[model samples]
Target: MYGYIKGVVKKVYPSHVIVENNGIGYLIISPNPYEYKLDDEAIFYTYLHVREDVFSLYGFKSEKILNLFLKLISVSGIGPKSALGIVAFDDTDRIVQAIELGDVKYLTKFPGVGTKSAQQIILDLKGKLIDDEVEIKLISDAGKDVEAALVSLGYNKADIKRVMKHINVDQSADQALKEALAYLLK
Candidate 1:
């Protein structure tokens, strides 16, 4: 029910952070908790998870990433931990790339993912992400071309725009387009 939390960081560990809002300290689990520092004023996109025996807060730096995490956890075989691992290692683009490429090997590298889960991720999430929202770090030559080809192939302009945004100019346009399309399609 919480939209976001603004607070001073009380402590930071490798996998968790404590943020003080008002007089209370909230222990939040995150993919890269170490990226934050003590005493810093920070805003965390939060997910409050309540179960019979546990209540936990999972936090992320951006709302986009947090939405992706929520989507990941909705898959049948994926859990919060697996979703966090995916976010930890892959940005929005890369995860979409892995899904578009049907590269189970790359996906399985994340903690707690295996062959079955990887396949499930691909099956469940393919074509489900908003093309404009996928974020990736590296755009290969192949990726560029694919994106352009998709535009030429009669895909939606918004789709092309979103895909193009993630492409790195250093990559050949054709290849970057391809990778972008892969992410977009995913």
Candidate 2:
């Protein structure tokens, strides 16, 4: 029922943070607890996960990531920790792209996702997570082509993602690849 919490960070831990709002402290499990600082004012978009005897409050820095986590947990073989590990290690855009493109190898790179789980993620989420028009317009097909080309050249996802931030999505794949290579070589 907690949509979000605006509070001062009271404590920071490896897997969670304690946010004190009003007079109570909330134990908020986060994918990246290091993102928060002690005593910093922050807003955490939250998800309350309730199971048989455990109640957990999972938190995300952004609503988009929170939504993606929700979608992940909906898959039969995926659970909260698996979903957290996925989002914690990869870019959300890349995750969506892998799902849409049915790239099982990329999905399996996540901590808890195996071959079967990766396939299930594609089966359950491809063509369903993002609208085609938004996907094409925002992260243009050309951009993805450039990313695939870079991956083929033995570059890691983190480096490719770093260069991608400098790429102009509107450009042709050839042009984008040239720009990305220039950035990578520097």
Candidate 3:
């Protein structure tokens, strides 16, 4: 029944973080727990997975990632751990693109996903996962340059995609790059 948690990260483990809120520490499993540094105050969009033997909370920095994780676990044969593993190691856009494009090979590269599971994911989610707000488009020449610059500076495509939506495509490459760097650094 818990939705999101706002707290300071008390501990960061390889697979999960402990977030302390209202004097209670919550064990929240996450894809990249290291993304949360100790003592960082933040909000985590959460998913509570309940089973006969387990009661667990999975958290993500963004609601988009939380939604993706929910969709993944909805597919037959995919569980919370497998879905977490997929999102943990890959970019969100890349995973959506793979499903939309029916790239079973790309899906299979994730841990716990084999050929059959990949096909099932494509079959179930191919046309359903494209976010209404974020549509992937072909980047302009200037956009490509800006993306490359961001990649070189250690930003991933998922982060680039999130920031690129706010960039002006008509701007000059240098201007666009400058704008992208500013948005990304924020």
Candidate 4:
């Protein structure tokens, strides 16, 4: 039931960050740990996923992302990893919009989400965000090429997601490719 943790980042892995607080390091699984740097003091709005044998902490840099993750995990078939992957790939706002619009096709594009699950997401979450006043701003089509380029370069979707914050989808596909490559290589 811990709500948040403000600590210094001790390390950043591909899927999680180690945050140190009160001489204890908390391994918080995050969608994009690369957004944080070592030794930087920051606050993580968090959710602790607890089950019979599995206990893990998931943290987000922003409340919007945290809330979105919570909503995704609440769906019947979606787990924390699936929910994290969806948001990690920049599909939060898009998922919200798809659910709102009853766009099952768009919902199925997310990893681990099949037709049945997409329908469930739409059924469970549609009209949910409207009451919360969450805005939906999906990225442009250029993201496909950028994602493809990263995949072609042997970077998995999870790894590519860490660099997405630096990309601007307003540019052409080629530009997004180059920008994403530059960031990934660095």
Q: Which structure among the candidates has the greatest TM-score?
A: 1
Poorest lDDT segment (10 consecutive residues) of candidate 2: 130-139
Q: Which portions of model 3 miss their true places by more than 4 Å?
A: 133-186
Estimate, for each residue in 10-110, the C-alpha lDDT of model 2 and write its tens digit: 99999999999999999999999998999999999999999999999999999989999999999999999999999999888889988866779999999
| Clash numbers, per candidate | 23, 0, 0, 0
What is candidate 1's lDDT per residue for 51-137, written digit by digit as tens?
A: 899988999999989988998898998989899999998787778777765679999999999999999998887656645454432
| Deviation of model 1 at 149, angstroms | 5.5
lDDT by residue for model 3 (76-149), tens: 99999999999999889889877865779999999999999999998999657865565445456788788888
RMSD of 2: 10.6
The local distance difference test score of model 3 is 0.87
Q: Which stretches in model 4 have alpha-carbon errors above 4 Å?
A: 132-186
Compared with the true structure, all predictions reach lDDT values of 0.80, 0.87, 0.87, 0.80
What CA RMSD would you report for each candidate?
Answer: 6.2, 10.6, 11.5, 14.7
Q: How do all the candidates rank in terms of TM-score, highest first?
A: 1, 2, 3, 4
Select the stronger candidate by TM-score from 2 and 4. 2
Model 1: lDDT to the true structure: 0.80
